[model samples]
Target: MGNWDHLVGASWRGECWAGARAELPLLLGVLPFGLVYGVLGLQAGLPGWAVVLMSSIVFGGSSQVVFAQLWGAGVPAPVIVGTVGVVNLRHALYSASVAQLLAELPLRWKLLLAYLLTDEAYMAAVGRLTSGPRSAVRHWFLFGTGFTLWAGWQLSTLGGVLLGATIPAGWALDFSIALTFIALLVPSLRRRSECVAAAVAGAVALLAQGVPYKLWILLAALAGMLAGMLAQALQRGKSHE
Candidate 1:
């Protein structure tokens, strides 16, 4: 959130279309996620409408799955809300990382971007965002990426709603989520600090596996960040020596 001085009137349609195109590969994994969620929601006795609507309302992917899982288990609404909120706190880091790129946008654009900044969408847009100098046109790029993902989510959830249990559980499309993340994460762990962070986080996650509501993800993420920071600090110290 910055002042309006840097705001430019220019917007690029080409960048937006390109961004949408770029996001297509990521959706391959994301579509099955919605399908799995949809099937699980139905099996949980969530009304079809609720399952479909959750995609738009919660839109937080894993958090939504946690919500449905807890809901099915008859968890209290307050507890569900709290747990989901805790899980979603990772987005705070995402916002912090991308804040500068979007700082110049007006309130409406900021709000839209905030809503659209899901995990896959953010990954899709971030490269373009940091690839070069900031341009208002890049906002459209994010819009394209985020909107494509959003639409994919909605449509896939709908597909799941319509398909129901007709799809075999054995197909195990859920694995795609892990595969997608691996695709995103492995390439980025090029530095020693990143590798250290990832290793520490993975260990913490396995150690915290029993924690409910997928809270281990948040714990792992925090540990990874701290480890990465410490690694960077030690590296710098050694270099200075």
Candidate 2:
């Protein structure tokens, strides 16, 4: 029994490590973004404690940015909430996709993962699962990897808030964050439908850019989702004909 227990513990540890390794690239890419968010949050006049708490509680970079911008600009609270809520609408699709795979998991595990399910982690895990036979352990592996990225984001954000003033304005770490987002987005430009959807979203955002308090981001996301779903349906129809 002692030997069996040791073996089980070792296996669990290995699984966690594998998951963490799979998620490391995303965490690397996310570090700069988190730092940028912290600096921008401070620059936008959000309190330091609010920055840290937002990272821990909200844990959504884009939404956090939107919230900070709205707060600084004195936008109404309802508008801010509505805007952030729209930007986070993608989480629904992610939750549905991952939910099918995690159906056997406990309610608590599902709820926890749903909270932590960012775009990067969801994309990474979906690719992994699609490229192999299904396994019950994949969820645990994803949890490990996603959790690592989450912690890295929080720590990086905290560091930025602390050292933001020291960093030179000309350094433009924020631009590096934008570049990182582009790099992350490049791989996602896979299918023709997806490409079309992205183009449509960009166009919509540009057209709506003058709208108040960053509502355009939400509009862009909605436009992209609708376009992507339409494109997918058309492709499926063509296949059946």
Candidate 3:
């Protein structure tokens, strides 16, 4: 029993390390975005404490940026909630995609992971979780990824808060958000259906740019999924012919 316990501990540590290592590269994209948000939160009149605290509580960078922006704009509480909620709908999809991988975890583990699940963490560790045969320590992999991202975000945001108004407008750190997402997205377009989905989503996003409250994101995601499904169906039909 002692040997067995020791082995399990070692396995857990190894998986955690691997997960964190995989996530390190993506931080290049996430750090700049966090810095931009840090600056934005201050510019939007959020106190330094509030800006850092939101990172802990909200834990969603994009939504946090939207919240700060809307709050600065004097948008009503209800409107802000609606907009933030809308923006975070994509997280539900992320949860669903990884649900099976985590289904067997305990409720406590599930709750912790659900809180930690962010786009970067998910993108960093998911392929590993999904690729091989299920391992006992797989949840640890996600835990490693999520915790590392959480730390990085906090540190980056703190750096931003410290920088405050000093950051140059010419730096354009917010572009990191687009670049990071594009990097995550490009590798995932493995199938023709996925390509179709991305193309349709991109078109819809461009066309809907002026839509209020960033509804274009939701619209683009839905359009992309639909287009992908249609493309997949047509491909299947052709194959059957």
Candidate 4:
């Protein structure tokens, strides 16, 4: 029995390492984005510690960027909260998608995974879970990926903060945040519905650019989701016909 248990433990560890290794490529993009956030947060007058703390706590790149931008603009705290909440609504969808697979996990495990569930981590985990033979200890694979990413983010944020302090503000590194978002967004626009949704949302954002409290972002996200849903539905209908 002791040998059997030892073998199982070794297998689990192997899976975890495999998952972390598989996720390394995605970390390339995440590292740069984290650096961008750290630099922008510092440039926006956020204390270095607060910027690093935010990365550790929030762990969501786009939302963190939005928060830094709003906080730097002197937006009210309540509004910033609401805006960040809206921006992170996609995580709910992610949770729902993976909930069934993780239903057997303990509450503590679920909570930990939920907290670590960023875009890159989720995509990597879901692909692993769906494409391969389902392992009994697959959640450990997720843990490995999430933990690796968490460490990478913290280190990258720290590097950016340190580097940002020495760089001049006139260089305008903050604009790179928008470019980072665009880089992330453009790749996800492969489907027709996705393209339509992005186009509509971009137009709405431009049109509502003057909206107070950055409400335009929320409106644009909603519009994009709706447009994508409608387009998908129409495609399904045509397929049925």
Candidate 5:
């Protein structure tokens, strides 16, 4: 019916805007962090174009920071690359979650969606698609959220790179980056097992702080993932008993 079509049409557009709006807060939260990254990247003597390209191409903030830090320290290229890969291994989880909603889409669309996938966008899109038709307006929502974030991140990084030198030393904004990660992790720590996994990870990272070649980050991540998976398995076994 014409009425049904009109209703679907309206909902699709509205859903996109709604999804974009939902991500607005996160966008604001990430802006300063991105700016900090840009500023630090330049201060560390990374090329301006390299900073922009890293953010534009890789589009992962944490990984970019690690790479810049290691590169500045004169670490080998392979070590820097490996460190970034380890830092971003968490994106695998996001890809798996988003892939479920996109299975029926064309391969081209799936590829584009995969490229757009990020921490905040994936989280928002997954929550929005709980009951909706997968094909209805999910991709639109994803596009709106992902596009907004992509724009914000690019602009913020550029701003930081251009103004890196003038930013005062007393701002103490670097700490905010760690605060942002804490905000992200706090909400994901609902279950006891998740909390334990996080605690174990924090302890390992601290203990391994003196390790060479930044192997501690990789070790900490693998140990945490294993501990969390084991906790879930044990919990499930107990429940089925």
Candidate 6:
């Protein structure tokens, strides 16, 4: 019995390590973005500790940037909270999608995974979950991936904060955030429905750019989701016929 238990533990650790290794490539894109956020947060007049604390607590890159930008610009606190809430609405969808796989997990485990769920982590985890045979200990895999990303984000943010003091304003590091998002987005347009959705979202965002409180982003996201769902339904109908 002892030997059997030891083997099981070893297998679990191996899976965790495999997950961490698999997530390393995604970190390449994430690291620079973290650095950019740290620098931007500092440049926006956020204290170094506050910037780092937000990265630790918030952990959402785009939303954090928006928060720092808006807060720096003297936006009211309630509006800042609302904007962050709207921006992170997609996490609800993410939670729903993965809820079944994680259903049996303890509440503590569920909470930890939920907190660690980010775009990069979700992309990596879902691909693993769907494309292969399910493992009994797959949650550990998620923990491994999430924890790896969490560490990377913290370290890179620290690096950025340290360097932010000396970095020149002329370097234009902020544009890199958009480019990073584009890189992440382009690869996910694998299906016709997804492509249409992305196109619609882009159009709506562009047309609604002047909307106050960054509401255009929320509108664009909703429009894209609806477009994608409609396209998928049409495809399903055609397939059944």
RMSD of 1: 5.3
Model 3 agreement with the true structure over 196-230: per-residue lDDT tens digits: 98999999989998977656766776788799889
In candidate 5, what are the lDDT values of residues 131-207, reduced to their tens digit?
A: 44434666777777877788899999999888886876445554666687777789868887787778888889789
How displaced is residue 171 in candidate 6, in Å?
Answer: 5.1
* Model 3 pairs whose backbones collide: none
Residue 42 alpha-carbon offset, candidate 1, angstroms = 1.9
**lDDT score at residue 231, model 1, on the 0-100 scale:** 99
> Candidate 6, after superposition: displacement of residue 80 in Å?
2.5
- The TM-scores of all predictions, comma-separated, are 0.75, 0.85, 0.77, 0.91, 0.87, 0.86
Task: Report residue 105 deviation for candidate 5 (angstroms).
Answer: 1.2
Candidate that scores best on TM-score:
4
Best by lDDT: 4
How much lDDT does each candidate structure score? 0.78, 0.76, 0.82, 0.83, 0.76, 0.82
- Which stretch of 10 consecutive residues in model 6 shows the poorest summed lDDT? 1-10
Measured by TM-score, how close is model 4 to the native structure? Answer: 0.91
- How far is each candidate from the true structure, as Cα RMSD in Å? 5.3, 5.0, 4.9, 4.6, 4.0, 4.6
Winner of 3 and 4 under lDDT: 4
Error of 3 at 36 (Å): 1.1
Pairs with steric clashes in candidate 6: none
lDDT of 1 by residue, 1-241 (tens): 1122322343587667766887899898789888778877776679999999999988987787777767876877777787788668768767888898888889999888889888888788777776644575778878889999999999999988888768664455445555655665797677899899889988998899788765675677678879988999999999999
Clashes of 2: 0
Candidate 1 segments exceeding 4 Å error? 1-11, 167-188, 191-241
- Give per-residue lDDT, candidate 6, residue 227: 94
lDDT of 6 at 114: 94
How well does candidate 6 match the true structure in TM-score terms? 0.86
